[model samples]
Target chain A: MIILNQSKLNPSNIQPSEITSREVFENRRHFLKAAGFGLAAGSALLLSRQSQAAIAPVTFKANSRQKISGFSKTAYGAGEKLTQYEDVTTYNNYYEFGTGKSDPAIQATLFKPRPWTISIEGQVKKAKTISIEDLLKLAPLEERIYRMRCVEAWSMVIPWVGLPLASLVKWAEPTGNAKYVEFISESDPQSMPGVRSPILDWPYTEGLRMDEATNPLTLLAVGLYGEYLPNQNGAPVRLVTPWKYGFKGGKAIVKIRFVDKMPLTTWYKAGPSEYGFYANVNPNVDHPRWTQSSEKPIGAGLFGGRIKTKMFNGYSEQVAHMYTGMDLNRNF
Target chain B: MKKQHIVFVKAAIWLFALLPLSRLIWLGVNDNLGANPIEFIEHSTGTWALVFLLITLSMTPIRLLTGQVWQIQLRRVLGLFMFFYACLHIITYVWLDFVFMWDELLIDVAKHPRILVGFAAFLLAIPLAATSNSYMIKRLKTNWKKLHQTVYLIAILAVVHFWMLVKKDLTEPIYYAVMLIVLLGIRVYFKYQPHLKSKVTKAM
Candidate 1:
C-alpha cells in the first residue's frame, strides 16, 4: 500500500487568483467558520444528509469509488449535494449519449468505460498515456461537493469524488512548455450515440489554457455522492472546473494534449458567434442567445428568478487570476 | 360563395383560432414555461406559426381537389393565424430572450445573418395579414396577389430559422421543408407545367 504522508501531499493553493468576480459569492462555512462554528462539528452534517440523498438514488457497484478526501469525515456540508442527482443523472448534458437529457442516461452503458485509457501527450515532459485504473490507484478518491454551473444558466451541487488536477500534474513531471491542455472525448459512434449526430463534428473536444488547467479548482472527477459516477457523468473520468460553465469542463476525456495555443472547443466551434471559447460562468457576459446574470436552480425552488448566477460560479478565489489582463467581455 | 359556406367557414375558423389564443393566455397565467420560458414560448408559438402556414398552404389544394372554392376563404383566416403566432414567437424571442437585453440583442441581431432573413419574412407577412380583410383585398384589387405571394419566401425562412435552432434529428424541420416543397411544387406544376397535372383529381 502506498502510504500518503502529510508532507508529501502537494496542496497547490490558488494564491495568484485575483478574485475579479468576488462580489457575488461567499462560502457559507467560511462565513460560519468566521462566526466561530467548529469545522469538525460542521462536517457531521455530511453524514446527517445521507438520509436526504433521494427517495431512490441509483445504487452502483459498491465503493468502486475511492475517497481521498483531505477533510475529516465529520467535515461535510458542502452546498446542496443532492441538488440534481435525479435530474442530472436522468436528464444529462452528455452530447456523446445524445442531445436530450434522458438520452445519455439510456445509452452510455454501451461503452466498456471501466478499462479506459487517457492519452497524456503534447508539451509535457512525461507525455505518457495513463490507464484509468493506474490513475485512480495513484490517488485516493476525495469527495468534494461542488456547484456545477451550466451555460444554460442552471446550477447543481454534487459531491464529486476524484483527485485534483494539480495533484496529477505534479506526478506527471512537466517540462514547462505546456501552455494549454486540450481534452478529447472518445469517438466511438456505436457506444457514443451522439457521434452519429451531425451537431458539431464527432469525438467532442474541449480545452483549457495552461493556467486554468493547473488551477486548484480544476479537478479530474471520477465519482459523485460517494458512488461511482453514473455513465451519464462521463464514467471513468471527467474534468470539473467549478467556476467555468459546464461545457468548459469536458466529460469522458480520452486525451490530454499540452499545447502552446488554446485549442478550439466544441461549443465555440459549433457557433463561435454565439458561444465564446473562454466560457467562464460570468453573469455579466450575456449569451448571444440568452442572459447569464441569473440561473434556475435545479430541483425545488421558486419558479421565477430563484438564484442569481455568480461570476466564476463562486470560484473567483481559485480561478480569477487566470484571466489576468485580458478583457473578459471582449474574449467572451 | 354560398350563404351556409361563408357562415360555416367563418365560425369554424374563429373557433379553431381561439385555441391558440387561449393556450397562450394559460401559459402566461400559469407560468408553465421552463427556466428559459422565452425559448419554450418562442418554440411553441413558432411551431403554431408553421402549423398555420401548412394549413394555409393546404387550402388551395383542398379546394382544387374537392372542387370547393369555399376553402379559398379559409386560407385568409389560416394565413392571419400564422401571422398571429409568428408575432408572438418574435415577441417572446425579442422581449424575454433579450430581456430587452438591447445591446447584446442588437449585437446578436447584427451578427446572425439568418435573423435578418427571419425578420424580413415576419415583416413581409405583416402587410399580408394587415391587407387580409375583404375591404383591403377589394381595394388592392390586382396588387393583393403580389403582396400575398411573399408568403412562399416567408414559409422558407420560418423553416430556416427552425432548422438553425434545432440541434439535430431534423425530422420536424425536414417535414416542414417537405411540406413546403410539395406545396410550392403543386403551385409550379399547376401554373407552368399543366401537362404534369393528374386528370383524376380525387380529394382526401
Candidate 2:
C-alpha cells in the first residue's frame, strides 16, 4: 500500500535520526549483542522492519510512471500479499538494459517506450503494425495479481494491469496454419547497452504454443501497480504467462509473429541444455545450474527463508490441462 | 625487512582484507544492498574469497619474479583470509539462503555440479587453513608442505565453480581463469627451467 517515489527519496534525504544505531543495524552483531545481554526476544521483528524501511525508497519515479486509470480489479491472486511496488520496479530481469537485476532500473532511464509500434506478422489474416495507443484501446483493462517466478529461483507477486493476451490473439484473427506465437523485444544498441554484448541473441525473443497464447491466464500487461508500465518493466506492453518462468514475458516488444513452426526463444538458443521452449514452472524438473524445488520470495526480509516451489508456479488448476500428456522433464 | 616492519605490514594486510566485510555492513546499515540483499552479500563475500585466493596464489610467483622472501611471508595471512571469506560465503548460502533446509540443500548439492564444485573447494581449503599456524607447521614439517600444495587444485576448482554458474557472458569467469593460469604457469615454467638449461648446454 506504500506508494514510493524513487526520485523523491534521494539518498541525501537520509537523516541521522532515521538510521538505527549501528549496533542494532547489523543483525548478526545485534543478535550477538542481544544474546550477551540475554534480551534476544523481539529482535527479529525489529530487524525485518528496519530492512523494509531500507528499501522503502525504491518505487517508480513520479515523473517516469504515469498513473493508469479506470481498470477493474479481478479475483486473480485475491488473498496473496502483493510485493512492494518498490521491489517490483527496482528488481527486474530486463536484459536489454543490462544483465544485473538492478541494472534495468538504473540503465533504462533513456529508453523511450511511448510512440511504439508492434508489427504483427506471419500467418495472421493480414500482417499489420499497430501503435501502442491503438493496442491499449483493444480491450477493457483489468488488474490481475499474479505470482511471477523466475528461473533463477526468485519470485514476486505483482498486480499487473492489462487485458488478457487472448483478446489480442482474437483481434489479430490468426489463420488455421498459425500454431505458434513468437514475441520479439526491441533491441537498440544506442538505448539498450546489454544488446551490444553477445550474451544472448539481439532483439530478445520468446514464444508460446497457440493454445497457451490464447489462455485466459496469459496476460498482455501494459501497466502495473496502477501506473503505466515503467520503461524497465517493458514499458508500453509485455507478455505475462504466470505459469511459465519470468523469461517468457518478453518486454518492449516490437514484433509478434504467428507462425506454424515453434520459434526458438532467446534463452533456449543461448543454452539449449538448460533452458527449454515450454519453460513451464515445474518443481520436479531442475535447471541445470540450480534446483527448481524452492524459490526465494523477493521483499521477504533477509531472514525470510525460501518457500517450496509449486507445480506450474501454483497455477496448475487453470494451465495443467494444456500440458496434460507432455513430458515436461524431457521438454524442460 | 625488519621484524617490526613485517608486523606492521601484516596488520595492514589484515585491515585491508576486512574492508570488504566492513563495506557490506555499511551497505546493510544504509539499506543500499540493492533489491536482493542476500545475493549482494553472497556475491561480495564470494568475490572477495576468490580475490584473496588469487592473491594467495600470487605470493610464490611474486617471490619468484622479485626474489623477495617477504612476499612469501605474507602468503599465510592472505590464504587464511581467503578461507575466512569462503566460510562467510558458504554460511550465507546455507544459513541465510536455505535456513538449514538440509533436504533441499542436499538435493541441490547432489543435482547441481556448480554447487558441488564450490563445496569441494571449501572442503579442501579447511585443512590448509587449519595447519597454517606455526605450531602445526613445525609439528608436520615436510608433510605440511605436501598437504598445502593442494591449494593449486582448490584454486582451479574455485575458478571452475564460478565459470559453471554463469548462464552466459563468460567474461568475469574467464578473467579469473586467466589469473589462475598465469599464477600456476609461473611455477611450472620455473620447475622445468633447470632441466631445460641442462638440455641446451648438452646440445651446445
Candidate 3:
C-alpha cells in the first residue's frame, strides 16, 4: 500500500526523452524539479524516530488517558507520537492555537509555555494569576477522544487529555455578572508571528457563553497524542469543545476574563458574515463561503469523499440543551 | 499551411496547454488537492482559465507594444483554448462540487460569491468562443461586433473573481490587474482614436 502511493508519483519519466530536448521544454525542467521535491517528501515519513529528530526532535507519547480503560486506541496518532505534516496542520485552523494551524506551530514554537501563568481577571470574584503547574495540580486528568470540526470545513478525531473546564472555572469562582468566559492567549509579535501578519490582532481571543463554559463538555486540554502537547497543537493548555468548531478552543492561553455580554471572537472580529460566536458544528447553517454539511478528515487527502457533519459535531446529546430555544441557523 | 507544420504546431500547443491542466487532474486523482477538494479544483481550474484568458487578452497589446504583428495569429487559438480550460473548470465544479445535485447546486450558486463571478465569466465566454468563426462573422456581420463587446465585461469579472478569491498577499491579483489594465488600455486607445487606430493596426 505504501509502495503504491510512491509508484504513481514518478516524475523522472514524466516527459519523454524527445520532449526534454525540444526547443521549448520549460515544463520538462519544471517537472524534473517538482518530482525531486515529491520524492524527498514521500521518503520523510518512512524515517525512524531518531533520524527525524535531526530535523526537529519533538518526541511524542500517547494520550495518558488511553492507559486508563476501554477507550480503544484512536487514529489521532494515539498510543504514539506525531510528526509534522507541514501542509496539513500548518495550513488548516486548530483555533486553540489561533485560527491558522500552520501559523501557530511556526509562531508558537517560540512561545515559552513552560513556567507560564494564566491570569483570571474581569468579573471573576477571586481574580488572580496562577502558574500552569498549580492549575494542573488542582485536577485529576482523563482522556477523551472527541470529534473536532473546524468552521473551515475539516474535521478530526482527537483523543485529548485534560480536565473539565468547569473544574478550573469553579476554582476561579465566577461572580454574578459573568455571562461569558473570554480565553486569551498571550500576545507577543516576537513569539506569535501570526499576530505580526496583520491577519488578526495580537493575542488570539475566544469566548464561551457562561453556561457553555460550565457544561461538562468543555475541557481544558494540556496534552494530545498521549504525551505532552506539540507546539502546533496548542501546547501547555487549551480548550477542547469537541462539538463546537475548533476555533472555539483558544490556545497558548494567558488570560481568562469573565465577562457580562457575549465576547467578540477572532473570526467574527475579522468577518462576522462567516463565523458566528457560537460556532457549533451544524450541517444546516452553511458558512457564507462554503457548506457546513460536510467535512474532510485529515490524511483523507483530496479525492476522499466527505463525511456528513453532524448537529453539534455528533455531540448533541451532551450539549444540545444549551441552545434549546434559539434557532441554530441564526446562532450559527 | 503545410500538413506537417500544422500537425507539429498543434501537438506542441496541445502539450503546452496540458501541463497546468494535468497538474490539477493529477492532484485531484491522487487525493492531494486539500480539504475542500471540489472547491480547490473549482478555484484552481477557474484561476488557470482566467490566466489563460488574460494571456489570450494580452496578445494584441503585447504585439502592439512590441511591434510584433505576427503575434496576432495566436489570439484565436489562445481564445479557443481559454474556452476549453474554462469548460473543464466549470464542469469540474458542477460535477464534483455540486455533484450535479440541482437543488444543492442552486443554493451554492446563490450563496458562494466566488462561484457567482466564475459562473458569470463562463456564461460570457460561450458567446465569445461561438462567434470565433467565419460563418458567425458572415451571419452576424454587423451584430457580431456588438455582441462580442461582452469580452470586456468578462475580462473585468475574470480579474475581480481572482482578487476576491485571495484571502491575503495581493501580489498575484496585482500581477493580473497590470496585464488587464494594459489589455483594456490598448483597446480603449485604439477605440477612441479612429485615425490612430488604422495606423496602430497597420503597424502591428
Winner by lDDT: 2
Worst 10 residues of 3 chain A by lDDT: A1-10
Which CAPRI category fits model 2?
Answer: acceptable
For model 2, the local distance difference test gives 0.85
DockQ of each: 0.04, 0.25, 0.21
True contacts kept of each: 0.02, 0.56, 0.17
Could you estimate the TM-score for every candidate?
A: 0.69, 0.87, 0.75
Per-residue alpha-carbon lDDT of candidate 3 for residues A216-271, written as tens digits (9 for 90 to 100): 87989887655556666776788988889888888878899999989888878877
* Per-model CA lDDT versus the true structure: 0.69, 0.85, 0.68
lDDT of 3: 0.68
Better of 2 and 3 by lDDT: 2
Off by over 4 Å in 1: A1-83, A109-111, A123-134, A143-147, A152-159, A259-261, A267-277, A282-311, A327-332, B1-38, B61-70, B87-136, B167-175, B194-204
Model 2: clashing residue pairs? none
A18-53 per-residue lDDT for model 2 (tens digits): 544544556665565758644544555555645533
| lDDT at position A234, candidate 1 | 85
